[model samples]
Target: MNPELAVLYAKLDIYGEALQTIKHESGAVCPNFMTCTCPPCRASYGSWALASEAIEKATKLSQSASQPEKPMSVCTKDEPD
Candidate 1:
């Protein structure tokens, strides 16, 4: 229920729904303002890392599911010489 986590989730393309959930839970901007250099900022950075990891995993799963079993190939053995 951290605003920092919500912001990080929002920025992730694959986890936009997660971000929306966060926003619904916490109705406020992230505590770590651009100029913030406090513990909250560090926490936000950590949240961002977690969100990025989720995005990467989701992307891999999506790609794997959509990939074709057989790859396309072209033959040119008898083409122009």
Candidate 2:
């Protein structure tokens, strides 16, 4: 599957479907392909890394944009999520 398309699907929150598309288009299981040590696999890893970074940046941007601005306050050690 195209790295760009994968990034798009990730942004759209359709990861399982994106992975399926990648498996169909590339004819390789996602994990095996990602970790393969051959030259092509190494290149794919680089491409995938770039796409992942882009997706992360976009997600952060969307989240930050959607949030209301507020002042930060220090929390005590007892605080929890």
Candidate 3:
């Protein structure tokens, strides 16, 4: 995976976790707590969640693709049974 992309994905993951924690601790008095129709809540949980999921999937695919395939091991005729 690209180093920059990896870093950005990691940052997003942290941000998502932080938001979750905040939401859990905050009450309904908080605009973005639980389920709010506020613009910030929509941007943070709606758009940001979608973007984070996309980035996470991309990161996983890139990591899996970059992995080296294992070479098949062959027994040599000279090897003892």
Candidate 4:
């Protein structure tokens, strides 16, 4: 796997975990009853777009990575077999 792809996957995992944690916490409190001005919510909202973009990029990269590559020729036509 490519190093850049590895890094991107790690970042995606981190962001996904964070979003899950935030979702769980947010669900604990009803937003309709109270105006939640929590740091988690703020952070989650702020980074949501970035996380989504990361996921998109990672998905595309993984899809491309899964493709089979053509075998390299050991000798060119000009070279003696």
Q: Assess the local accuracy of residue 25 in candidate 4 as a C-alpha lDDT between 0 and 100.
A: 45
- Name every residue pair that clashes in candidate 3: none
Among these predictions, the greatest lDDT belongs to: 2
Q: How close to the true structure is residue 47 of candidate 3, measured as C-alpha lDDT? A: 50
> Which of candidates 1 and 4 reaches a greater TM-score?
1
Cα lDDT tens digits for candidate 1, 26-67: 322355433465667656655655656665687799899998
Off by over 4 Å in 3: 1-40, 72-81
Candidate 3 lDDT over residue span 1-81, tens digit each: 999999999997897676555444433444553378776665556654555566577679889999999899998779678
Q: Candidate 3: what lDDT?
A: 0.66
Assess candidate 4 and give its lDDT: 0.63
Model 1 clash pairs are: none
How many pairs of residues collide in model 3? 0
> What residue runs in model 4 are displaced by over 4 Å at the alpha carbon?
1-45, 70-81
Arranged by lDDT with the best first, the candidates are 2, 3, 4, 1
Task: Give me the runs in candidate 2 sitting further than 4 Å from their true place.
Answer: 1-31, 71-81
Give TM-scores for every candidate, taking all chains together and pairing residue i with residue i: 0.43, 0.48, 0.39, 0.37
Provide the global lDDT of candidate 2 against the true structure: 0.67
| True lDDT of residue 68, candidate 1 | 83
Query: Which lDDT value does model 1 have at 49?
Result: 55
C-alpha lDDT score of every prediction, in listed order: 0.61, 0.67, 0.66, 0.63
